[model samples]
Target chain A: MQHFLRKTVAVFESLGDRSLDSFERLGRSTLFLVRVFKSIPFVFLRPWLLIQQLYSVGVLTIVIVLVAGTFVGMVLGLQGYNILVRFNSESSLGTMVGLTLVRELGPVVTALLFAGRAGSALTAELGLMKTTEQFSALEMMAVDPFKRVIAPRFLAGFLSMPMLAAIFSAVGIYGGYYVGVYLLGVDDGAYWAQMQKSVDFHEDFMNGVWKTVVFGFVATWIALFEGYDSVPTSEGIGRATTQSVVNASLAVLGLNFILTALMLETS
Target chain B: MTRQILEIWVGVFVAAGIAALFMLAMKVSNLSTVSTGDTYEITARFDNIGGLSIRSPVKASGVLVGRVSNIKYDKDYSVAVVTMSIQNRFDSFSIDSRASIYTAGLLGEQYIELVPGIEDNYLEDGSDVVMADSALILENLIGRFISEIISK
Candidate 1:
């Protein structure tokens, strides 16, 4: 009876501890976010750091975005053609491909890819720095590590996302055109005409840009936060890197849906 | 040397992004409309607009001439009022020119198709296009098909 009572107390205590731990994590994350935002001015002041970060994060990620984008567009062309053929409206293929890529798939897919590619790298790099006491070394040298280390990468990731998304969407449209027009033989004129008639610059394109910007900020924030707070060990670095990718990807997708709904509903 | 190379590549990347955006705006979203010289406004009333909304392209002979600027309900006339902006270059449309709402495909966006008339006199700004055909609603057609089958 005494043993049973002790087990019950232990379970309750663990639950309390879990809640407290999560609350503490939330508080820490908020503080980290503020610190990161405060470090933004340093990104402008130290342009070379931003450029280096951009090269590592942005330039390196371009090929993947392009390859992924092209394939996605081709698939959209094939599927949209098949469905539209049933309705005897295959000529609207361009509208389907353009709207899908520009409004929804482009930003969302690029962000997920960005999260997987850059977010994980940032987390791992920072975690490794932590493990090797590099951040501490900077502190000892009277350097603000947040401005020196974190700000440039954050700015690069934030800036790179929208540009990558734009490229993806553009390449995707071409892929769609090749498949829909050349492979499937949909009327080329009607395809473009339909798209031009339907798509609006202010409504679809700008909304997509807004979404990617927000996603970029969120993704970079999660990556940097996870890195900054990771335990100073090899296993901890690996875990934080995985967590950063997973968390950023999920946040991006959730925000995409909310933003899409708000954008579509409003205008 | 490495810095210069990297800067060049970065500049190329930024240029490509901007170029892609320009294509999106100009070719895809019709941003060239702003450069389309001055336009004259005209109004048309329709019995039913169906899915026609503001900014729907106004086409002449399958060529884009202008766009629908606004849509409002004409309560007194029991119809929908559609305001259109026809470009100055294409201002030769006669007063008797017919305006019809047309759908490109079986399932596609609706647009305004203007058919030029024989009248040599041209339509002026703020003039009402009296002859107009409303859009054919799909649901109504489907209903008619069902009712015809029932009667048969």
Candidate 2:
């Protein structure tokens, strides 16, 4: 019993040490990122990273955004019309649709969609690389894997989410317009004019963009961290992929709350 | 690689063009003014404006002809002074044109519906329309309904 207790204590101590080491590495990595940012001109000069990011954030996820935007818009319009007709106040359809799309739906839905697409792909790619000892080979050759492997994805995710968010917002508003004017037979002039008047472009647009950037960072960081720290087996790769998606999704939601609070307080 | 790059560029252009067209359609549908020959202004006083905001459509017989330009409080009268810009083509709006604050749909928006009067004399600019209906406040209506139910 004494020997077992000692063994358990030793295991706990090793875990504590490993956690401390992880924290230390995280601090060093953050500092490294700061240094990299200082040399951002050189970083931006590399077209490969930019193209990768654009592809990840914009081109690859086009179908998801298109489908999500259309459906959400349709539902919002249909529901809004039902509620408005109850009070015979159908003219406010534009305001309802515009506000819903800009403030909430645009950022949240786009990020969720991105998490499902690029988030999963990123995790799988990184996990496979870690499992195959590719990362070990890079380290053996004295290549900084973080810079070569992780940084491009990090930068891409950071850039891509906001661009995707902008597309989502624009398309969503149009979808709402389509349902409101054509299907509902609401006066088109009234709908557009009210939307234009109520929605302040800066507040909605900038807030949406800012939220997406934070979402991007959280999604990329969690996925990469899971992939990098994965156990050395096939089962470990599977576990890491699952954990990556779960953690990234949770982080996205938590960060969204924090950002919304900050924006409200500052505004 | 070059072909792939060209394809991406084409995709980007097409996406941008589609977005621009949608924006253009929305703008043209809402902002363009109809030339109604003679311009007239009518003032309607209401206790509450509700969702009667600026540039909200003013419809007559389900046809949009003008818009509510402004809403201001009449300090002495304690009423909302709503100014509507009507096109000149509907020139026969006499003293009896009934203006009602009505909503487009349930959970939709509020607009003023103008019922043209039979009197031949046209309303001059800045003239007050005598027949005006106050906007229905949703909360008040609900409260009144609940109270009635309780009383019964």
Candidate 3:
């Protein structure tokens, strides 16, 4: 009885501690976000740094975006074609493929991929910099690390997500087109026309764009924050990088659900 | 230099993103298909709208001439008041024209079909269409058939 009571007490104690830690981290993250935003003006001042970050963060991620987008789109086309043919409504294959990609999969898959690839990289890079006291060195030289290291990377990531999602959607549509038109022998004109007829620019496309923008901001912030808050050790760096990717992915999916619900309700 | 090459690549990537957005807008979305020219509004009341919704195409003689812009329940008439915007170029609707709800294909979306009449007068902006027919409900037809058989 004593041991059981003690164990229950210990569990409650740990739970309380965890909640407290989470609250502290949330407060720190808010402050960090403010600092990052405040330093955004610095990004334009040194345009070259922003470009470099953009290259590393955005350009480097293109290959995965393209490959994943194509495969997703092709699969959608194949599945959509099979499903839509049931009611002799195979002509709606384009609408299904286009809407599914533009409204949901494009931003979602790109964010997940970005979290795995660029998010992890950002965490690791910042973690290593912290591990080597590079941030302190910058401070010693009167350089604000937020401006020099964090904001440009944040801005680049934030900018890249929407663009990458757009590319993903575009490639995905083409992939669907290839499968539906060439492989499945669907009428090309009907496929394109049906998609255009169904998909509203403001409702579907712009909503997706906005979703990516929010996702980009979230993903990059989590990655950068994990690195900034990392304990100064190799194990800590590894842990932070892992946490960054996992947390960013979970945050993105949760935010997508909320955003989708709101968008659907309004539309 | 490698730096210049990187800059060029970044520029290309940005441009590609823009192009992709443009392609999506043009080929995948209804941005281009939506009429931007002058339009005239027509209102009609129906007893039942069925599955009629906003932005549903309004057709004339099997050709699209307008779109249903809004749908609201009228408390006074206890009916669905539907507002449609027709393109100015196709401004040939007579005052005695009939507006009926139609379904596209089988089990597809509903639209409003405008049948022209031989009246000399034309329907102007904010014209209230008096000759409006409500949508056909399949369940009602089956119910009526059952009732007639029971009575017989």
Which candidate wins on TM-score? 3
Encode model 2's per-residue lDDT on A1-267: one tens digit a residue.
999999999999999999999798678646656643554454466756556555654577777887888889888888998998897767878888877877778778888887778777777888889889998899899866666677777776766676666667677767877888899988888787777656644455457667877887777777766777677688988888888788777877887788888877765
Better of 1 and 3 by DockQ: 3
Docking class of 2: incorrect
Kindly list the per-residue Cα lDDT of model 3 for residues A1-267, writing each as its tens digit: 999999999999999999999999999999999999999998898999999998999999999999999999999999999998897888899999999999999999999999999999999999999999999999999999999999999999999999999999999999999999999988999999999999999999999899999999999999999999999799999999999999999999999999999999887
Q: Which residue runs does candidate 1 get wrong by more than 4 Å?
A: A1-20, A187-194, B1-5, B32-43, B60-62, B74-78, B85-99, B114-132, B138-152
- List, residue by residue over B14-86, the lDDT tens digit for candidate 1: 7777777777777776455544588999999999998998778899999988889999998998999999998
Candidate 3 local lDDT, residue B47 = 99
| Tens-digit per-residue lDDT, B17-133, candidate 3 | 889989998889999987789999999999999999888899999888999999999999799999999999989899999999988876889999999899989999999998999
Indicate the residue-level lDDT of A199 in model 3: 96
Q: What lDDT would each prediction earn against the true structure?
A: 0.89, 0.74, 0.95
Per-residue error at B75 for model 1, in Å? 5.1
Ranking by TM-score: 3, 1, 2
Off by over 4 Å in 2: A1-42, A140-142, B1-3, B6-152
> Which 10 consecutive residues of model 3 chain A have the lowest summed lDDT?
A84-93
